[model samples]
Target: MAATPALEIAPEKVAHVIIKAREYGAKVGAWNASTEEGDADEDPSAILEDFASDPTLGEIAGFIDALNDDEQANLVALAWIGRGTFEPEEFDEAVDTARSEQGNSTASYLLGLPLLSDYLEEGLEKLGFSANDVESDVL
Candidate 1:
């Protein structure tokens, strides 16, 4: 079997990102957009509504932005690996590509992926890390 790839980004950090990403991904776009306001008891679905000004988005983005450049690159590479763009053995290549191909903000680029949480989790698993275990610890 191929050797497990090492990760520059800590599993704990990645787990944190996964948790936040899951929260962000669970949001629905303005499901309660109608001006009709209702009591929480009447419309609990409001909690799932995602407004353009939602802080969750900013929170996750800021968390990702705080990481150094190498961490950001490794993050992108991990996502790529999870998404099947590269094999686990190609980790270094993936990281190198991530660095060279960086254009927009890493946070922006990553946040744009609807399946960011899944991809990251899968990437961690592929690298022989247990995302679930790390995530539980993070929580």
Candidate 2:
């Protein structure tokens, strides 16, 4: 394995983002018309419903938006690495690209990715950080 490069973004911060991203991704569209008749009190699965008012989305976006420019760029680079757009050894290049290509809000860009949680987790692992360990600590 290659030596893991140091990260401008902290692993714990990434872990928190991963946890929130998973929560947001796990949400399903609102109950179908047929299932809408089901009693909400009895349907434990209601928690999975993606209501427009769900706070998870906003929380994650806000969190990402709060990161410094370098951290945000590194976060995007990490995702690119995990998504196989770049190898772990190409970390610097990925970061450079992320920095250069950033047009919209980092939060918006990252939140748009359907596999954000998985990518971040894989990125952390590729960088030789234990996602589980960091997540455990955060939890």
Candidate 3:
């Protein structure tokens, strides 16, 4: 006999997860810098790079990277919505709070959020999760 499986969740669901995670991170002040208003013409990657370089922020990014594909998606959303500077001390506290409240890392929390299928699919693939696996509970 064949085994039945849980239906794969939708890609939008995955995107939603990312959104939630970002918002949570933002509210907790998980920003990449100390200020929001920059040169206005500065490159975004530079900011991310800066964040990646900071000891605390870099640790956070590593944490973000550790999240499952679903978490990765939401981290993107969080970044989209919560762009700008963040106080590391405050952000650290928030990360702790987010963890207690969300029951997962900020990134993983967002992965369960809703988002466009195409984006979610691509995100999952990037995170090393099979898009098909996302469709079901195999993973």
Q: Estimate each model's TM-score.
A: 0.92, 0.91, 0.23
Q: In model 2, what lDDT does residue 10 have?
A: 91
Displacement of residue 15 (Cα, Å) in model 2 is 0.2
Estimate, for each residue in 35-66, the C-alpha lDDT of model 2 and write its tens digit: 54434588888888887677899999999999
User: What C-alpha lDDT, on a 0 to 100 scale, does residue 19 get in candidate 2?
Assistant: 99
Candidate 2: stretches off by over 4 Å: 1-3, 32-40
lDDT of 3 by residue, 1-139 (tens): 2322221334445544434333334332224466643332664433333332234334444555666654443434323323322222233333334444555555443333433334445545543456565555522
Best by TM-score: 1
Off by over 4 Å in 1: 34-41
Top-down lDDT ranking: 2, 1, 3
RMSD in angstroms between candidate 2 and the native structure over all alpha carbons = 2.5
Give a tens-digit lDDT track for model 1, residues 38-135.
Answer: 34576788777787667899999999999999899999999999999999999999999999999989999999998999999999999988888999
Looking at model 1, residue 84 earns an lDDT score of 92
Candidate 1 accuracy as lDDT? 0.89
- Pairs in clash, predicted candidate 1: none
A best-first ranking of the candidates according to their TM-score comes to 1, 2, 3
